[model samples]
Target: MVEINSLDENDVLFGVVASDRKNRWLGMHVDHDQTPPLPWWMSNPNQMPQWTNFLPGESNNHEYHGETRVQMRKPTGKWNDVPCDKKLKCICEININ
Candidate 1:
């Protein structure tokens, strides 16, 4: 996950990645369970608001990446999708059950 366990690491990484102006890959990916697709994290039974979070004009827009997958831009933390092929830094989260 982009969120780090250590505060110092978080600060350093946040500054470095945020200034780069590139997408940070999320560990979660799209699953076509419904319209606009859903990321793995959202699909979890406990997760709510699964069908929302698409910014204005963002859902399935295909403007930048035809094979759209989830991405999050730094600072603003806006959720969006980009091409699956584009290489970017990754954010990971561990789910305990």
Candidate 2:
């Protein structure tokens, strides 16, 4: 099991592949089991939207090297996904349970 950490608005997440999601909204799907966004002093706790690049059985962008961006963080620090082809800085959190 893996969870991509959430970021606050204006919070920068490095190393992300650029994605061309329609309207630049980022590829998204309804995932009921995804973790909630992190809560900070100024961050809102009510907006933990779950999103993913790959939509199974759905047509999607197959651009660059990575058509499906597995893990990504938006510059706004919100939950988002990007193209896996673009290379950029990113952070990973590993927890042992």
Highest lDDT among the candidates is held by which one?
1
In model 1, the number of clashes is 1
lDDT of 1 by residue, 39-97 (tens): 55433434433333444665463753554466666765455667778788776565679
TM-scores of all predicted structures: 0.51, 0.28
Question: What TM-score quantifies how close candidate 1 is to the native fold?
Answer: 0.51
Instruction: Estimate every model's Cα lDDT from 0 to 1.
Output: 0.54, 0.33
lDDT of 1: 0.54
The candidate maximizing TM-score is: 1
Put down candidate 2 lDDT per residue, 1-97, tens digits, no spaces.
Answer: 1233344312232323234221222323223223331211112335443432323422223342333333333432333334545554444334559
Q: Which pairs, if any, clash in model 2? A: 7-77, 14-89, 14-90, 15-88, 15-89
Model 2 stretches astray by more than 4 angstroms:
5-66, 70-74
